[model samples]
Target: MMLSEKYLQIRKHSEQICEPLEREDYVVQPIVDVSPPKWHLGHTTWFFETFILEAFLPGYQVYNPAYNYVFNSYYETIGNRVIRTDRGNLSRPGVKEIYQYRAYVDAAMLDLLKAPISPKAEELLLLGFHHEQQHQELLLTDIKYILGHNPLFPVYSTTAFKLHHDQTKEREMISIKAGIYEIGYSGTDFCFDNELGRHKVYLPEFSISSNLVTNAEYLEFINSGGYKNFTYWHAEGWDWININQISSPMYWHLIDGVWHTYTLAGLQPLAVQEALTHISYYEAYAYASWAKLRLPTEFEWEVAAKSFDWGQRWEWTESAYLPYPGFSKAAGAIGEYNGKFMVNQKVLRGASLATPEMHSRITYRNFFHPQLRWQFTGIRLAK
Candidate 1:
């Protein structure tokens, strides 16, 4: 696809994800981790304006000077902006205004792409495309969070998304022979900097499940008092469950002794056959402990990823979010993307249904705090 076409398609998809949302839904940030839908729309546009239009397009006019302060997300080098927690507090530059901002920037971005562009500008444009795609995934999940948390448990769209149903194949472990393996992104494609620095790691033979842990399987854990059993949980995970009174995965509810979960399609009976999602790394670890198994390391996951079907959920790995042997940050605000976030987070391999098309490479390293379960996270066992 042409660069301009790809840009428009991605930009449109972000807005399309929000089509079912009410104006009120756009401003909700139920938790510090979930940015409001409006914020995502504006922040993604600001990325293009700041990085591509302003930096590359000569005499390009910024749509709104104040948007830089409102939409700038965590580039310390990019100057001060709204903190994550306070994103929901702003009511001005409301949903309509945010959409207008998107249109304004989209026009300038298209104009810039019409002419031959320098390699640096093209690089930033591609990065901006993927960056917006990242936000597109967030937009859907955030919309789910906003609607799912409401007492009404309102539906975002009746047909837009369906929870992943259970795998039909019988569960089995796929054996991987022990060997030194090349890890990290090796392809000459657009990948985040964190996926670079390809290096080798030695691994012993291991077996990983061909299927993700299903809701029925997890329900067994719940019935067996998995949440109550501190033995299965890490010390910190145990504390998180207790302090937050977390008893089940996010959006899960036991109503009249039946399990139901909130989805974009609205509150519905939990399909035990479906792959489990909205789980934290802590939950994944504890569940693995209870099953007398362990989660795969990221390297093990990459090696075995081709052997099984994935992309149903973001599978948690038993690896910390750390840089590779030769990892180095790209200089400037872009450098702040992944390198600095390499602490206190766990690596999640594969991809979730919420992930955008062409965005789920095996080397993609998604990290989040261990206690966060808002994203579509799941588990696969290794031993």
Candidate 2:
């Protein structure tokens, strides 16, 4: 497909994800990490404007100059911006106005793409499309969180029933002998900067589960008093358990002894054979310990990934989110993308059901605070 067609398709998909949301659904921010569905719509549009239109399209009129202040996220180099937590507070732009802003920016983007593109312009444009795809995943997850926590427990879409279907793949462990191996993305296609500077790493012999931990398996952990036992949890994790009083995965409820969880399809019976999802790093770590196994390091995961199926859920790995060897940041605002986030975050390899097909690759490194369980996160055990 041509670059222009690809750009339009990606942009359309982002909007398609938001189609199920009600106007109210687009405005709520239940947690700091989860932006409003509408905010996601606008912020992605802001990215193309701030990076591509302003950078390359000379005489490109800014679509509401104030949006830069309202939508700019975490780019300290780009001048003063809204605090991350305040994204939900902006009520003036309204949902309809944001849609207008998106249409306005997308038209300019398509017109620019029609002409011969410079290497720099093409690079940023591709990055913008990839960036939108990241938010497409976020849009679904955030919408889930917004509805899941509501008193009404609203359904985002009926199609979410597809996620509850059981997987028939037999469970097995794939063993890898200890050895040095090449890791990280080396392909010529577009990849994030974090996947760059491919390098070699040594690993001890290990075995990894063929499938993600299922709801039935996690239920066993719960039935065995996994939450009650402190030994299964990290020091901080134990503290979190006591403070938050978490007994089950997020959105789960024990209604008269039946296990049910809120999904995009609304409340439904938990599928026991389906992969356990919406779990935190702390939970993943604790479950591995309970099973007398461990989470794979990012390098170990990369080496064995081809041998098993993934992309069902983002599997937590036993690795910090630091840059690979010889990694460097780009000079300006874009530099803030991945380099600065290396601290205090756990690495998750593989993609989730909500992840856009083009946005994820084998070397893609996803990170979040260990306690965050909002994304489509699950466990894959290693030993």
Candidate 3:
């Protein structure tokens, strides 16, 4: 597809997510798990305008110069952004004005996409397309998090990501012998900067589960008083649990003492075969240890994932997210993608249903804090 067409579709997907939401729902926040919908809409526009249009388009006009401050997310290279805590207070721009801001930029972006001449410009446009998809996932996640806080427990859509029955079964355990394995994405189409610089790392011999740990399996963990007992948790995990007084994953709640998960589609009985998602890396690790298993190293995960449903869910790994050997970043603000975050985070392989089909790949390394479980995070086991 031409870059313009692709961007149109990409931008549309971001809007499509809002079809089920009302203006009143735009600013909801149950917890820290979500950004306001208005924020997401405005932020993605800031991405293209701040990063691409303002840099390359001659005489490009910003809809509201103040938005440059208000919506500029975290790119410090680009002046100042409106403070995050105040995102909920921007009732002046409201929802309609934000859409107008998006529409104005969408027109300018299409103009620039057509006027672009250099291969570098084209590549960056593709990067923006993927960047928008990332936000589309965030849009759903943030809304779910916000709705989760509300007593009504609103449902966004009924489309299911998993089957009604638990079709996932335990297959023969595959043992990978100790050796060095190549890790990271090597393809050339487009990737987050973090997935570059393919490198090798040593992995110990280990047995990994055939499929993700299912909701049914996790129910066993909960029924066994998994949250009540700190013995199965790491010290940090214990602290996180206590500090937050966390009983389960972010959206999980008890109804008549039975576990039900809240989502964009309201509350439902947890799908038994679907991977048990929204657990932190600390929780994933603790749960693995409880099962007498360990989280797979990223290298081990990259290698084993090549043979399974690597696109289904974000698979947690034991390794902290770090720069690869011989890794170097691109020059300038575009470099903001990944070079800075090469510390104190665990890598999750694969992608979730929320991820655009285009961006999902085996070697894509998504990282988050060990104690964060709100994204579409889940677990696979290593023994």
Candidate 4:
């Protein structure tokens, strides 16, 4: 299928999902983990309107003047943007209104895609599609994060999930050759800026676990006083836990000494064999240290995942995310996406359960601050 046709379907379906919600739900951020659903709807449209439509559409009309500022998410070159932490404050554009706005843009975008598109405009449109997909994934994460805090703890969707335990015995740590390993995307397909120019590095002789750390295994950590022992945690992690008086993963609850977790499908008993998720790098590092293991460096992770499917949950790695060696950012504001986030965060390998299979690939480096854990993050331990 042509990229344009597929994107149109996704675009329309995205709007359809929010149509059933009331005006209030669009802005019901509830906390920092969510953006107003209205904002997500419009901001995604703004990407096409700003990056592709404005540049390509003849006699293009800017739908909302404030949209440039309101929808510009994290593009430093694009000037100031609406505050992400305060996304709930946006109430001027009601939920219904955003859908109308989306409809107008969708008609225009489809029209443009039907006509001839310049190479630059076409690439931007493709980028816009993937950008929307990212937000689509975030839309789920953000809504779940918000609903988790609600007193009612409302369930968003009634879709059933698979919770069956895969009884395959855990594999022992497997050793891969520790020679010089070239890591990065080898294909010409679209990828984020971080995974550029396959490069070489000397990998020390080490072994990585065949699978992710399970919920059952993590239970052992808690049983063994993992949080109570300061030595198992990083200095900063310990301080964060102490200052916050942290006890367990964010979504976990201990009611009368029994464990449970909240999910989009509603609260359920925590499954032990399920991959441990929504964990910060600090906590992952600490737990690995406790188990006499280390998180694989991003290079090592790429070397390992290069053969396996990188479409699973995002794997926590030992390397801090940074620009590739001899890498240069693409020209224009789009360059802001990956280059700006190159510092103060660790690299993650593999996709999450939330990510679509089409978007996941080796050398796709996802990163977050050591203490942040709002997404599906888990560890693949190494020694």
Q: Write the per-residue lDDT of candidate 3 for residues 40-111, one digit (tens) a residue.
A: 999999888877888788999878888888887777777887777777777768899989989999999888
Error of 4 at 137 (Å): 1.2
Tell me the deviation in Å of residue 66 in model 4.
Answer: 1.7
For all candidates in order, the CA lDDT equals 0.91, 0.89, 0.79, 0.77
Clashing pairs in 3: 69-82, 155-266, 156-264
Model 1 scores a TM of 0.99
Best by TM-score: 1
Report the alpha-carbon TM-score of model 2 versus the true structure.
Answer: 0.98
- Model 3 residue runs over 4 Å out of place are 160-167
For every candidate structure, what is the RMSD over all alpha carbons to the true structure, in angstroms? 0.8, 1.1, 2.0, 2.0
Per-candidate clashes come to: 0, 0, 3, 4
Model 2 over residues 1-383: C-alpha lDDT tens digits?
99889988998998888887778778898779989888888999999999999988889999899998888888999878878898888786999999999999989998898898999998898888889999989888888898999978887888642455355799899999999899888998899999998998889899998888999999999999999999999999999988999989998899899999998888888888888999999999999999999999999888999999888899999999998989999989989999999999999999988888777888999999999999999898888
TM-score of each: 0.99, 0.98, 0.94, 0.94
Candidate 3 TM-score versus the reference: 0.94
lDDT of 4 by residue, 1-383 (tens): 77668877778656655544545567877666568777888899988888887889898887887889888888888789878887788777776777788888888887887867788887787788778878876776776677777767677666532322232455667788869988777787787767887788998887878778877788888889998999998899999988988778768887777888887667778866777888888789888988988898888777776444344467788888888887788888998878877888888888776764377777778888888787878888888
lDDT of 1 by residue, 289-318 (tens): 999999999999999999999898999999
The model with the greatest lDDT is 1
Which segments of candidate 2 are over 4 A away from where they belong?
Answer: none
| Candidate 2 clashing pairs, residues 3+ apart or interchain | none
